[model samples]
Target: MATEGLRALLHSVRYEVLPAKASEEKVLAHVPRDVVVTVTASPVKGLEPTLDLTTRLAGHGYRVVPHVPARLLRDDAHLKEVAGRLREAGVDDVFVPAGDADPPAGDFHGALPVLRRLGELGSPFARVGVTGYPESHPIIDDDITVQAMWDKREHATYIVSNLCFDPRVLGEWLVRIRRRQVELPVHVGVAGPVQRAKLLAMATKIGVGESTRFLTRHPSWFLRFAAPGGYAPERLLTRARDALTAPSSGVAGLHLFTFNQIAETERWRRALLDRLGG
Candidate 1:
């Protein structure tokens, strides 16, 4: 039954939250104990918030994965300090990304360099996640992005796809990954049920500059979805579910970008799961 499948899927889902805006108490209050949670590092806000949030989350007994944006790290020394702090907080997993910052902060321009440094540190985390673009990235070319993942696979435990609306793109991308011999399991990204207007407004307010690239790549689709009417992630999920259920697909799970709309997201997830008989 769908409910059984939903329950199974829930065990693997990781909910993402912005560390800068999410309060420890607020996060703890909203996040269920069973779901794994990840804190994102904002390029503009720096890494302190993520560190603080992760520490608190770990203290509360939630499995926490903190983002380590390459542009925010200053050097190997900074990396060591961050790792030390995370270890002290009983945190392990991390999601390393090239980051949206315009200029390089130090020696690491991308996740590969930072991941290499983490490897040298001999951290204890069993998992390390890297970003993947199921659709075209805003800035990087397809070839470059593909190579980046291939290069990071040695150090990364999984691939979490960037947000995308098209399930076909995701499905085909997964096939391509396997064909190319990039074997890391994938966590498909989906925005939780969001109001179209709200998504657009938030998108603009957040100054997600890279979104321009997404828009450029899919202008018609973007425009159609940008206007009134709500946005349901089901269309994408339907496709992802098929891929995930396939024996040879190698898809891992879902990474819900809740956009700090925790209550609504949780409600939707729970309702859907229950409907699916989870």
Candidate 2:
């Protein structure tokens, strides 16, 4: 049943791209064309890299979702240009995160404001997604993070939970979200099969404090990476299989934080599919 659930969950995957320049082709080559790929935004690096990456990925026939960080846009003009550019590139979906830019770059403060602005600009995106944190966010409080989901429910098409190691935490959070009556399909975020050292280095590069908090929560999984055995996405999926299969949880699909370790991750995914005879 667990393998079946994992197989079902694999049908649609959301691959997140790192903010820096790497071999976009090298990483993306490992992913299937039909899969959904998302580009991450960096406050320091700005959204230009992500836009370039998104356009390139779309050209390669991948459905790309670029992160439109609210704080990154300086004003209405900037927002409008971005919206126009996305539509021009045939990119119809966007993931709006409040962004990690401390102090923010402009008037926009959070995801809701960006969503509203997008609507004012004709909601250029066909599908809009918002972030969901099952585990407590390193910076934000538990209450505020949960409330943000309810707040953005009207604008977002779906919810993608942030990378979470504990299935119990994910299950409980899904039940709570459903209880609150948020009907959007929730795609659970699980780390792809990445080497421990590589994962840590990538995490630190992205956000050291956030990465530290995540590792602090899952010491056993960290140890698994340190030794011969590495952390498997299936392990967490199997652990949370019951919650995922439950109808009320509204578990929709899988969201993989590939960390640009695409070749290794792709191999793991293909092997799992063959093992399941999918």
Candidate 3:
């Protein structure tokens, strides 16, 4: 089951890239152009760095999706300009996050508002993806998180779930999503094949607060951290295989949060694809 799920997911997996220095070269050199490479935004650097990388990637012929964090924009004018730049660069997709910035840089405070504003701009994105939380958010309540998805559905084309470590929680959340009648395709987020130390460092640097929260509450994960190859990305994928492949699941494929470990992640994916004969 895990192998089959891996096959289906690897067929159209998205490799999420960060906005770190030299990340663009790694992306161009190792990542295949066919795969959707999503560029993550940073609160400290703003959108300039992400936009520059996205344009460069698009020029090199990769299907790029940049994280359009709402808190980073100054106003609707900023979004309009950003959208125009993306359009000029041949970018047709975007993933919206509420962002970690305090007192959000401008009018919009969250992804929803940014989404609505995008809608007002004539739906500039061909595929607008919104974040989904399978596990409880650290600050937001469960109901609010669910409602946010519902509200954004009118504007978004699909959902990209944030990283989830527990398959049991993922299973329940998948069931819950379908029950709510939101049938948009989902790109399940999972960690890529990277060293545990690198994974934690990138998670903290990228503002994956949930990852930070999980680590804080479960100190014993440090035990795995101490071991070589501590991170097994397929663990959760294997457990949630049933839920992901079920009929009407609306699960499109996997979204590997590569954390810029493109080479390692690509090797792991190719080996699994060959083993599964995909």
* Per-model TM-score versus the true fold: 0.89, 0.90, 0.90
Candidate 1 runs further than 4 Å off: 1-7, 200-229
| Cα RMSDs, all models | 2.8, 2.8, 3.0
lDDT tens readout by residue for model 3, 1-278:
55666687788899999887878889877888789999988776689989999999899999999998999999988999999999999999999999876678898889988888888889888999999988787788887888888888888999999877778888788888888887888998887877867766866765565455556654544555566657687666777888888866788989998878888999898887787788
The order by descending TM-score is 3, 2, 1
lDDT of 1 by residue, 1-278 (tens): 43354457666788888664545666678778888888887655678989999998899999899998998898889988988899899887888988876676777787888888778777457789999987888668987888888998899999999887766777788887877878898887878876656655545544466445334554644564665564677655765676666656776778998767677778888877776666
Could you tell me which 10 consecutive residues in candidate 3 have the lowest summed lDDT? 217-226
> What is the overall TM-score of model 3 with all chains considered together?
0.90
Residue lDDT tens for model 2, 1-278 = 65677688887677787855674766566788877888888776788988988888888788999998898888878888988888899999999988877678888988898888788777778799999988888778977888889899888899989878888998999988888888899888888988888877876776665566556765665775676555777788778989887878887888888887878777887887888789
| Weakest ten-residue segment in model 1 by summed lDDT | 205-214
**Cand. 1 Cα-lDDT:** 0.77
- Indicate which candidate wins on lDDT: 3
The reply for model 2, stretches above 4 Å from the true place, is: 203-230
10 residues in a row with least lDDT, candidate 2: 206-215
Rank the candidate models, highest lDDT first: 3, 2, 1
